[model samples]
Target: MDALGIAVIVAVLVVATTIGLWHRRTDGMIRDEAADKKRRAAILAAAGVETVEFPDRKSSNAVASAAAKAASGAAAAAVHGNDTVRAANAAARSAAAGVPAAPDLPADSGIAVPVDSGVPAPAGPVDEAASAEPAGADPQLAEPGVPGVREPGDVAAERKSGVVPDSREEPGVVEAAARDASAAGESLDQGLLDRLGIGPAQATLLQFSSAFCAPCRAVRRISGEVAELLPGVQHVEVDAESHLAEVRELNIWRTPTLLILDAGGQVVKRATGVPSKPQLIAALGDVLPDA
Candidate 1:
């Protein structure tokens, strides 16, 4: 039609469309907020920290009736000096049944609520140390020198079962243990070689040692260091636990002995006592001529 008439119609249509969309958005937002509030109310009721009353799980219409009761009870408690009649009744039932009160919620002082079953107080006060810890702080949480306890998950029950029966492992026991482990099977033959993951295809440098024997450490340290530098060499540290068995079998007498074997698993060079770094390199050089 006319230009002014067209402009007026378009303006009216735009205003109507904007109003409709605005109302729709407002309604959606209101609905979303109500749903969120209901969800939060439900969560609070589940946690038992809500000001409103909700029936316990066993009750019929527990969730709905409980939510309504909780909202109403909260309003009532604010007006009625926090009567908490329902809470008191629940607590009373808990006490009579020898159940604990209020889940032992800790206060800001870090002390737990003392368990009571409506019973008389103990003849004496509870010991401060006897308080149960929150799982992780138990001293038995870790075994000494052991990185992770055996039961990887749920260590609580393990703390009770694997509780070190008052017999303490020695200090630096791991280091000493490692040393003793090295001395173990001092005269390891071919079978022990296979057990140690040393095969015919692998070159071997066996370090024989004895526990409580001095100078063996220095020898082991030097040979071990030199063996580390030699790429193809596999250092097998054997302990001299007893001379009567494998040592007698292997006809070995000296301690901190080094036996260099070629890739074919044949013994090529022998050093009695801890070999010097040069001696270690020379022994390996015989097995690995190029090195």
Candidate 2:
């Protein structure tokens, strides 16, 4: 053979060997599903659970319903609390500056009267001072430097600005970074569970597999064993070919991707390939019932 042909053969062999080594090195290891925070956040957001908590609160409802209710309740409460804080701050600013704060108009009286309307405008300013509480009425909204009022740079303004404090940096939030990332977002709903012939449990071993993948059967066996051994846990196997939409939406790139979901159907961890029973149990520690 010509030297050029031999060199071409050598190059092909080298590339093939390199690819094989890379795949073998990572075949069955449990690792973070997404490569970066942004990707992980995107996955969670796509799953309709951007801020649901982990195994801390278990649920038997379908993953979607539980996660949606939790996210809705949390958002409503936060918005309500922030609005209250803003109203209080406005009142405090007016009191400190000796300005008359406008009285709240009733909901039904919100229609604006046109300038040429026959209705007559009020002749004088409202006597807010007569009906409203005096300055420093609520100790919590008193001016800065008071005994209990928050200073100028407190988190009240941060909350008002819609700046969410980093969940990881928040007090009492430390854990293995990978585990924490897994816990952040990604949930499945009840309807999907029903369609897949699975029911809700405290924790779910959700396996995505295809017909031709030999290792997928092993993963199924391991997941089933884990589910049987662990109370409140269920094993659910899905044929990736049959559920192409879910497979694509979830970014399931491999034949045997297993999603470890908490009781509320929030995905707390994910792994691809066949996993040892011990490793599966360890991955489930966060959602497992307390012994």
Candidate 3:
């Protein structure tokens, strides 16, 4: 062929190659971005705070239909003397009613069932204090040594001065009263955790983070490492945006807010910024066993 024709053909080949390379590079970048997003989603799920997408009407209807079918099957089997099916039916009904289901005791289980009452007898000792408390009176507010309430020291001084004190006020008791107040607070915290579906751990380090916060990533790493080093310690990272209610309840006004919970799920300590590894370990020491 002619020299000019050969040169023109060569230029066309170079242009085509350049366009193909650019297209492939763009495709690779898109794939990489998608993969990174999926990896982050998996990490958040592992941290016990998953990003949930709102289901469309079709998907919601399908899920509801499936649940209804399962419930129907369980109810049908329950009529056939199947204990498991009976338990499932009860649980489904309770879930529909938005209440906790009663525990399903096996027929041969040694636990005694009260006659004339379909419920089992109480397994533990009754709380005398709860029984004695007057109706509509908050046990927590009634307790001494609590803020805005009568302090134990004041009660003692009043008793020594021959002033008649309230029956709930335990005069001459300070340390025990303080301990009781602390215990009451711990009990309330534990109950809150239970309602949130958080099980007991030796220590739970809850890190609240935002999507655009860079320091939050560092705190997550540090908290995860600390949890691994300490047995029975759990590390949970919550997305502050997704859990705004929890953020407001816990008074979290910043990203990378760390809440260190004791075994009883009580907030033992809290830090706002990124805490160093050593500082975190020191805080954990207070809640760790034998510390």
The candidate that achieves the highest TM-score relative to the unseen native structure: 2
lDDT of candidate 1 vs native?
Answer: 0.38
**Best model per lDDT:** 2
Mind giving the per-residue lDDT tens digits that candidate 3 earns over 114-225?
0111232232312232222211012111111111112345334434543211213432122111111111111223334544456657668878889999989889998899
User: Where does candidate 1 stray beyond 4 Å?
Assistant: 1-189, 195-202, 242-244, 289-291
Ten consecutive residues with minimal summed lDDT in candidate 2?
A: 107-116
Residue range with the least summed lDDT across 10 consecutive positions in model 3: 108-117
Model 2, residue pairs in steric clash: 64-189
Computed on alpha carbons, the lDDT of every model, listed in order, comes to: 0.38, 0.49, 0.45
What TM-score, to 2 decimals, does candidate 2 have?
Answer: 0.51
Better of 2 and 3 by lDDT: 2
Quick one: ranking by TM-score, best first? Answer: 2, 3, 1
Candidate 2 C-alpha lDDT tens digits along 146-235: 111124443344344443223233222111111121233344555565676767566788899998999998998999888888887889
Q: What is the lDDT of residue 211 in candidate 3?
A: 93
